[model samples]
Target: MSFINKMLPNVSLIWPDVWQATLETLYMTIVSAIIAGILGLALGVWLVVTDQNGITPHPVTYNILDKLVNIFRSIPFVILLTVIYPLTKAIVGTSIGNTAALVPLVVGTIPFYARQVQTALVQVDPGVIEAAQAMGASNVDIIFRVYLREGLPDLIRVSVLTLISLIGLTAMAGAVGAGGLGNLAVSIGYQRYQSDVTIVAMLIILVMVFLVQGIGDWLTRRTTHV
Candidate 1:
């Protein structure tokens, strides 16, 4: 008790903020990740499948989706926070809180992760697909049972990267009044010159990053059956 009390500044005031901020951060990261992961994976598979040499090539569809993905991925995230405020407001009823912050977070990461998924799927050995085809595997079987399974480890890696990047974006989102550790550190700590508050928030963010990284690595290892 004494040691912890000495380490933390104004324990009564700062403690609750730390816990709430941490929850807000995790809430946004996890929910956005779940939504992004599902959509990104589907969009990615579509990209790979619609290529000229793909199993179900449709050049027009591919070209359109490809362009859309490129456009969203090109937008700088901070600018995106405001550029899409009207859409965010429509979706969440307000564009300035943690819940609303998820709008841009999910949108930004979906394309980013979609491209990562595309690259991972593209790297799967061509010979493996040929083998599946030779065995009369349907397109759905090839996609779900083979490509996705073979790409699991890489998918896990990119998922972690996406989450970490999203964490940073959440901090940026804080600039718009979206509350989290970033908001706490910026609005209260840095603005007030409370270095201790800043330090604690930074430490908490670092620990969370490390924890996410550690879990991702473990999952990747487990998925790599060899």
Candidate 2:
């Protein structure tokens, strides 16, 4: 179409950089997702096991972790990035690249994913959990076989949500020179007054998001029995 042709001229000029930025975005997203998935699942299991009537009640520990999750989740990503700049620099030896962007991505996502994991785990049938316990199943067995198994669909759904959120955060990270599509949009498009470039970058991001969502939904539907 005429519209696309008009955009293509501008988009072609920045295609290589956009591709690189997209790769960086994917790297940050996938790495952080793996880390958050492991840690958040552990945190969620702990939260479930320590609540008032859980298998092993420990109000103090639960309270501490709960507060910690809330505190991290409440902080805006921009502020969190600035606040953790020193740690980022120390860890990555520079605070202005794709690798350095992982710090805030992980920090911002862990609490969010943990909360999602908790909600998903909590939705598992209480009767199923009780039955597992009544059968002399160990706590570990109950958590893995009962809780996680039953919550798989919801977990996938929420993981999708978390991944999508991470994309947005990566864009914000770009503002600080993380060099992703966000940076492409801001530095090349907005700052340079190239509306066409901005639009293309946004479209690419939107396409990526929709792809993620579609895959997540398919997985959820396939895994879910009810």
80-163 per-residue lDDT for model 2 (tens digits): 999999999999999888889998889889899989988888889899989999999999898889988999999999999998
Model 2's alpha-carbon lDDT is 0.88
TM-scores vs. true structure, each candidate = 0.95, 0.96
* Per-residue lDDT of 49 in model 2: 86
lDDT for each residue of candidate 1 in 1-226, tens digit (9 for 90 to 100): 7777777655346787789988998888888889988999899999989988778999999999999999999999988998999999999999988999999999999999999998888878888899999999999999998889988998889889988898888877875699998898888888888877888878888888999999999999999878
True-vs-predicted CA distance for residue 145, candidate 2, Å: 0.3
> What residue runs in model 2 are displaced by over 4 Å at the alpha carbon?
1-5
